[model samples]
Target: MALDEAMLELAAGGSTLLRFYGWEPWCLSLGRHQTAPNRLLGSSPDDLRPGVDAVRRPTGGRSVFHGPEITYALACPARAWGGPRAVLQAVHRALAEGLRAVGVPLDTVQSADAEAGFAAARISAASCFRDPAPGELTARGRKLVGSAQCRRRGGVLQHGSILLEDKQHLGDLAGRDIEPRGSAPAGVSGRGPAIGLNELLDPVPDPRLIVERLTDHVARAFGSPAAAATSASAGIATSAALTRLATGYERVHRSGAWLWRRERPLPAA
Candidate 1:
C-alpha cells in the first residue's frame, strides 16, 4: 500500500510507474470506503483465521484476497492517460494481448453487462473476483483479473489482482464459494464468469514470468520509452520522499483509526 502511494507521488511529479508485486502470509484488503464484512469482524475461529491480516487499500473497490495472485499498480498523470476510463480500457486491452501472447486467451467485460452481473450476484463486496466489473480481464467466461482506481493530484493510480491460482480459501473467508456455485446470474451478458491461469496453462507458469510479460505489454500501451524500462536505483531524494510518504500512509493503514473507521464512520469518506 505504501509503495503504491509513493508511485502516485511519482506520477504527480510527472513520472509514470508500473509495478508488480505480491503479499506475504496473504491478506484481505478492503476498499478505502468499504464496510468490512461481518464474518471478518467476528471472533469465531473460522471468521478470524490465524496468520491472515486485514488492511484497507488506498484505492476504492471491493475487498480482495491477495494470495496466489500477481498484483499490478500503474500510476500516471490523468492528462497523459486521457483520464480514468481511458487508462482502464488501455491497460485491460494490453493485458488481454499480453496474456494471449503467453497462450492464455482472455477477454474483457463491458460496463452495462458487468453492472448487471454485479447486481445479480448479490454477493458480499468482500469478494472482488466473485463479480468482476467492466474493463477487467476474463477468460473462458470467468474473471481472470480484478482492478480498481483512484484519481487525485492530477494523477491516477490503478491497481489490480491477476489470478494465478484458484483461491479456494476465499470461499471460507467469504462464507461462500469463491465463484458462485451454479449458472451465471440472470441478466449477466458475455463471459461473466471468473477463472485463473492455473486452469488454462499446461503447467502453471512462474509468477515472475507472468509479471515480465505483462509489464512489457503495459509499458507498450503507455508508450514508455525503452530507456525508462530499465530498473534503476532510486536517488537519495527520491528514496527520502518515498520513505516519508510510505511512513505516513503506513500509520493510517495499520491503525485502528483507519481499519475500523467504518465502525465509527469517518466524516472524510
Candidate 2:
C-alpha cells in the first residue's frame, strides 16, 4: 500500500502529490488494502488464473482491473486540498474537462445521499467500470471512471481508474453472462456510448497522453499550476521510510495469512 503510507507521510509533512501508474498484466485490485480472500469466500487466488490476479490497494473501493485503463494516485494535506469531496471532484472535474477538450462528452454523477456506503458483497462482478459514485464521470447512467480514497491523520491519498478500452476477454475474466462495459453500448439500454481517446483523437489513446493531460489538469485545479510537484525528491527519497513501507506491504499484502484473512483460524495459543 504505497499510496496509503505515502498519504501518511505527505499529510505529516504537508505536501501535495500526484502520480500516474499502471498494473502489470491483468490483476484484480481490491479496496482498503484488502485481499481476495476477504472479498471472495473460499476462493483460491494462489494460482491466479491466466486472466485473473489480485492485489490490495490502499484506497477504499470495489475491485477493478489493471488492463487497458489509466490509474492515478494523489496525496496532499486536507486543508491544502479541499475536504474529501472537494478534492475528489477537483480531480474528476479536471479529467472531464480534459476529455471534453479532446471531444469526449461525459456527465458527472453527484451523490445526494453522500453517506450511503458501498457494499462489496452485492458487487462480485468483474466490471467495476459499471459502478458510479458522486463526482465520478459517467456516460448516460453507466460509469466511465471510478475512484476511492483513504484519509489518514495528516493528508489524503486518492486513487482512480478510467476505462481506456473494452474488456477484451470479459467472459473468461469475470465470467460468462457479463454485461457490456467500457465503450460498448450494445446491451447498455439507453445509456450513452462509452467513448475512448481513440474516438476523440485521430490516433489511439495511450498511457502517456493520459498522464500529460491529467498532470496539467490537476495542477490547474489547485489554482497553483506551479504548486504541484511531481518529483520523487519529496517523500519517496527517504530510504528508511521506503524500506518500511515496502516491508509492510510485503508482510501484509503478499503474505498468505494476511491475504487469506477470511479463513477460519485455529484457536490462539
Candidate 3:
C-alpha cells in the first residue's frame, strides 16, 4: 500500500510508474471507501484464519484477497491518461494484448448498471472478485483481473489483482460462499464468474513471465520510453529518496487509525 502511495507521489512529481508485486502472508485489502468486513472486525486477529492480514487500500473498489495472484499498480498524471476510466481501459487493453501474447486469451468487460448495483448491495460482504466491475478483464467470460483507481494531486493511482489461482479462502474468511453457480441470483445479471489462470490453461505460466509481458505492453501503451540504471552508483541517490518516501507511507499504512477507520456495527444476520 505504501509503495503504491509512493508511486502516486512520484506521479505527482511528473514521473510515471508501473509496478508488479505479490503479497506475503496473504492479506484482505479493503477499498479506500469500503466498509470494513464485519467478520474481520469482530474476530480477534489471533482467531482469524492463518496467514491472512487486513489493510485498507489507497484506491476504491471492493475488498480483494491477495494470494496466488500478481498485483500491479500504475501511477501517472490524470491528464496523461485522459482520466481515470480511460487509464483503466487503456491498461486493460494492454493487459489483454500481453496475456494473449503469453498464450492466455482474454477479454475486457464494463459492469452494467445492474451489475454495479448488485456489487454495491454486497459491498459489505467485502468480496471483490465475486462482483466484476466495469473496465475489468475477464478470461473465458470470468473475471480475471480486478482494478480500482483514485485521482488526486493531478495524478491517478490505479491498482489491481490478476488472479493466478482460485481464492476460495476469501469466501471462507467473509463467511460467504462465492463458488460459481449455474444460475444467477434473482435480479442479478449472469456474467462469467471470477476465474484464475489455472482454470483457463493446463499449466499456469510463470508469474514473472506475465509481469514482464505486462510491463512491456503497458510501457508501449503509454508511449513511454523505458530506462535502466547503468550502474549501482547511478541509482543510489534515487533509491534513497524512494526509501524515505516509502518509509513514511508505510508508517501510515501500519497505523491502527487508518486500518480500522471504517469500522461499523454488523448488520443483523
Q: 39-93, model 1: which lDDT tens digit per residue?
A: 5554662244344577777777667777677887888887887877778778887
Candidate 2 — which residues are off by over 4 angstroms? Answer: 1-4, 33-51, 108-126, 168-202, 223-244, 262-269
Candidate with more favorable, higher lDDT: 1 or 2: 1
Q: Which candidate wins on TM-score?
A: 3
Better of 1 and 3 by TM-score: 3
Candidate 2 lDDT, 1-269, residue by residue in tens: 44445445545467665666665555566655343532233245443333345666656555665566677667777777758667776777787876666556676557543224333324443445554655577765556677777677667777777667545234222444322222322553222333334434466555666567777887788654322333333434444554455455455556555444433222111
- Candidate 3, residues 16-92, lDDT tens digits: the string is 77777777757778877776644554355323333346788887667777767888788888787777666777888
Clashes of each: 5, 1, 2
TM-score (all chains, Cα) for each model? 0.77, 0.70, 0.78
**RMSD of candidate 3 to the true fold?**
8.0
Per-model C-alpha RMSD: 6.9, 6.5, 8.0
Give model 1's TM-score versus the native structure.
0.77
Note the Cα lDDT for every prediction shown. 0.66, 0.55, 0.66
